[model samples]
Target: MTYTAPITEQTFVLETVAGIGEIQQLPAYESATPDLVQAILVEAGKLASGVFAPLNRKGDTEGAKWNDGAVTLPAGFADAYRQYVEGGWGSLGADPVYGGQGMPFVLASAVQEQLTSANMAFSLCMMLTQGAIEALGAHASEDQKQEYLTKLISGEWTGTMNLTEPQAGSDVGALRSRAEPHADGSYRITGQKIFITWGEHDVADNIIHLVLARLPDAPGGTKGISLFIVPKILPDGSRNDLRCVSIEHKLGIHASPTCTMSYGDEGNCIGYLVGAENAGMRAMFTMMNHARINVGMQGVSVAERAYQHALAFSKERVQVKRIIEHPDVRRMLMTMKSTTEAIRALGYLNAAAVDRAHGESDTEAKREWQALADLLTPVTKGYATDMGVEMSSLAVQVFGGMGFIEETGAAQHLRDSRIAPIYEGTNGIQALDLVNRKLPQGRWKPLFADIRETIRALPGDGDLGAIKPYLDDGLAALENATVWLVGNHGDGFDDAAAGATPYLRMFGIVAGGWLLAKQALAASERLAAGEGDPAFLKAKIVTARFFAEQIVPQGTALLGPITRGGALLFALDEAQFAA
Candidate 1:
C-alpha cells in the first residue's frame, strides 16, 4: 500500500509467521541468520524499489522490440540484469559447490517477491534460468553441470523450459519433438518449440534451452519425452542450429520474449542428454518443486504491486468525504487490503513450508514439511494470483477514471496478474491435483497429520484467541473435503470434474490462515521482546485476523458443494441450444 513494496510486511511474515529464526539450526542453512537475511533483503529492497520498479511502466509501454532475428529489451533491463547476476542473487539457494551463496530457499523466495513485484516480465528470464540450472544439477552429467551450472546459477546466461509445442500445450503427451542418437554419445534434436521464454537473448552470453524431445524407438506420449540441454552455442562453443523465428506480440509481460524456436534447422542442434533415457519427465520435474513456488510468488508480487497502487489512490483521491468517511469507498478499499493481505500470507506460508522441507535435516520432519509444501504450492499459485486480479480491480475502482488509463499502472496490474491462474498448470489443474492426487495417494494420510501437528505446535495467544476458532473450523472443513474426495473419487475422474477450482480455493484459505496463525505467534514473541516493528507486527495480527474470521469461512462453506455438487457440474444439456 502507499505505492510501496510491502517489505515490512514481508519481513514480519518471515521473522514471525514463517519463523526464519528457526531455520538457522538447519545444516547448510546456518549462514542465513535473521540478521543476514535482513541485510540481504534491505539490499534487495533498494534494487526492487529503485532500479526494477521504476521501469514497470516503461517496459509495458515500450515493451520488447523484435526486429528480424534480434529482440531489443527495454532500457536499463541489461543493467539490472548485470547487477542481479553480480550480486549472486541468482544462485542464493543453490549448492555452495557451484559458487552459490547457499542461502535457505526461504530467503531466496522472500527476495524473489521483490524481484517479480518490481517487474515480472523482466525477471522471467532469471526464473527460467534457475529452473534449467536445477535440472542440470539434479540430472546432468558431472561434465554438463560443470560446464553449465556455474554461469546459469550466476545468471551470466539465462534458461528456458521448452515443453509447449504446436500440438501440445497442457497435454504433455502430445509432444513430437525428436532427438536422434549421434556418434559422440550426444543427441541431435530437431523440433519446433513454441511459447519459449528467453529463447534467444543478448542479455546473457548463452541461452540454455531445456528442450523436451522423443528418442527413436522411445515409447509414445509423455513417457517417450526426454530432456535435452540444447544450448544456443555449440559444444566446441560456436552458435548452434536454433533460431528465434518470431516473438509473440500480445498481452502483458511484453518486455519478456516469447519465442518460437526452430531446432536443428541445419541438422546441427546437438542436444546433450541431462538424465538417463526416458527419465526426462523426472528430470523436468526436479525444477518444478521450486518453479511452482516461484510462479506463485509472481501472483503474490503483482498483487502487492496492484494493492499498493490501489491503496494509495484510495487514501489520496478525495471524491467524497465522511459518509463517516465515505462508507462505499471505504468498503472497496478495505476489500482490496484484506484480499491482498490474505493471499500474501498464503504465499509466504507456502514459502515457509518450502524452507522447512528444504532446510530441515531430520528425515521425518523433512517428509512431513515437504507434504505441507506439496499441499500449499498449488493453492498459493492459484488463489494468490486470482486475488491479484481482484485486488487490481479494486485498485481501478479506487482510482475511478485514472485507473482505466494505462499510464496509471492500475490496468496493467490486472492484465499481468491474470496469467498466474492460467499458467503453472492452470488453477483448475492445480485443484484437481489437490483432490485427486494429493489427498488419496497411497498411505499418504500421514502427510495431512504431519501438517496438522506442526500447525498445532505453533499455538495462538490471548490476542490470537479470535483467530483460532475459524482456523480450526477451516481445518475441519479441509479434513471433511479430503475425506469426501478419498471416498467418492470417480473412475477416470469425470463425475467429480467440476469442483476443482473451489477445492483449490478451500485449500488456500486453510493453508493461508494456518501460516498467518503461525506468524501471529511469532509476532507476539517479537512484540514481547520489542525486537519487531510495531506497525508491521500490528498489520500482521490484523491481516491474519481478517483472514481467519472473514476468509477462512470459505473452507467450511465449500464443503456443501464438494459433498453434493458434482452432478450439477456436468448437467449442461448439450442439446438445449444448437448455435
Candidate 2:
C-alpha cells in the first residue's frame, strides 16, 4: 500500500509533546511562535503529503539509474524536487542569512520525520543538502557563503557529504586521500570516496561535495585530515574534476544513489578549505550533530510508517477468527497499533528534548535537558530504527503472502529501514556512546533528581494511578542501574561493554513509556475540552499502559549484565569456532 503522511498524529504530537509556542516564550526561542510554526508545518506538509508520499512506491520500484557521470532518478523525483524548492521546504530550518525560511530545527525536525517516513530515498537528497549547508554556514568563508549557501538554501542546487573512503570508513584518521595545497589557496584533491548519497543527480544545476583529505606535511591519523568543498559545477558553470566512478547495488534504499566518487582524475579538482586545515574533524562535528539528530528522525519516520501500514493491514485482512465476536485479527492489529504509537511518542519526546536543550533560557535548565537529549539520542537512533525494521517485518507477516509480493510495498519499508541503525554512526557506536559517555556523565545523582523532579510535577489526579505504578517500576530499575554504574564505575569499565546494546534498548522502552504517559495526559486535557479526537487520546493512554505492562518489564531482566558483562565477552576464545 502507498504511504499516507500521518498528518493527524503529527499535529497531535506537536501540540501535545512538542508543546509549540511554549518555546516562543523563551528569549532564545522567541521566534518559535505557534502561528509561524503552524504555517511552516502546513506548507511543509503540502510537499510531504502531496509531492513525496505519492512517489514513494514508484521510487522504490524504479530506483535510480547510474551511467557514466550522471544519475537518473525515478521519473517523478525531479518534479518533486522542483516542488520542494518552490515551497521552501528544502531550507526551512537553515541559517537565516542564506535566504532560508529560518524555521526552528525542532519544528522542521518533526516535519522531516513525516517526509522521510513518507519516502526515505527521496528525502535523503534534502537531508544531505542540509548537512552541506551547515558545513558551509559554520566554516565557509564569506565568499563561499555568498556564492554557495544562498542557492543551496533556495533548493536551486544540492549538496553531499563525502567522508567515507573505502579504507577510512569510520576511522577517518586512517584515510589515504591526499590534498595538495596550491599557490592559489586551494587544494587539488585526489582519491575515492564511496557511499556518497546523491553524489550525482539531474534535479539540480550544481552539486557541492564536502570532502575530507590529508595534506602532505600533516600528521598521521585524524590529525592529518582536512575538510574541503569540491563542487561538481565550478563558479563559472564549468565542470569540476570529480566524477561518479560507479554506484553501488544495495540491498535497501535503492532509490538513493550510493556512488563511488573519484576526485582529481583530471588533476583539476581545485577545492577550497573550510575552517582551519586539519581541524576538519571539529568542523565535521557541526554537521554531525545536526545529521545525528536528523538520522534519529529516520528511525521515527520508518517506525511510524511501518506502524500505520501494519495497523491498516491487520484491520482489513483477517488472520485468526474473531474472539468473542471481536476479530482475533483485531487483537494483533491493536498490538501493532499500540507499539507503533509508543515508538512515535518516544521519537517526538527525543526531539522535544533537543529543542528544549537549544531553546531553554536557563543555563542549568539547558544543561539538564541537553544531557537528557544526549542520553536519548543514541537510544532513539538505535532502538527506534531496530523497532522500525522489526515492525515492518511484522507488517509483512500480517499481510501474509501478498506482503511478500513487490507490488504490495510493505517489503520495501523493511528494506529501507534496515540501513538506519547501520548509518549515522551505527547502533553499535550509539550504544557505546550511551554506555561510555552518556551513562556516567555529571554523576548519576543529578540525572536521577531530574527524573524524580519531573515525576513530581506530573498531575496527581485519579486517572494517573496506572502511570504512577509504571513510572515507579521504571524509576526503581533506573536507580538500580545508576547506583551500579556510580559505585562500581571502574570495576565494570573493563567488562561491561558487551551489554551496551541491551542497555540502550532498556533505556528506550522505559523512557518511551514515560513519554507516552505524559502525552496521554496532555491529550486528555484537550479531550476534556472537546478539542482533540477522543480515539487518538484514548489510543495514547491504552498504548502507554500496554507498553508498561508488556514492554517496560524487560528492563529488570536486562540489568544483570549491562553493568558488568564485558568479562564474558572477553572470555570467549579467539578460535572457539572459526567459520
TM-score per model over all chains? 0.93, 0.93
| Candidate 2: Cα lDDT at 288 | 70
For residues 409-520, write the lDDT of model 1, one tens digit per residue. 8888888777777765787887788777776653336645644764566545654777877877888887887776776676636545566677778877777777777777
Off by over 4 Å in 1: 1-3, 322-324, 442-463, 490-492, 528-531, 577-579
lDDT of 2 by residue, 1-579 (tens): 556666677767777666655765766567767777776667677777778888888888788898888899988888988888887887777777779766666677877887897789888888988888888898989999998899899999899988888887878788888899899888999999999999998888899999988888999988878999899988888999999978888877888998999999989898989888898887887777678778877877876787677666655654364222354445555556656666666667676776787778789999887887777778777788777777777777767798898777888888998888887688888887877787778534665565565466556655454666666677778677656654545666655467777777777776676667777777667778998678977777676666666677776567776666566675668887573
Q: Model 1: how far is 424 from its true place, Å?
A: 2.2
Cα lDDT listed for each candidate: 0.78, 0.77
lDDT: which candidate is best?
1
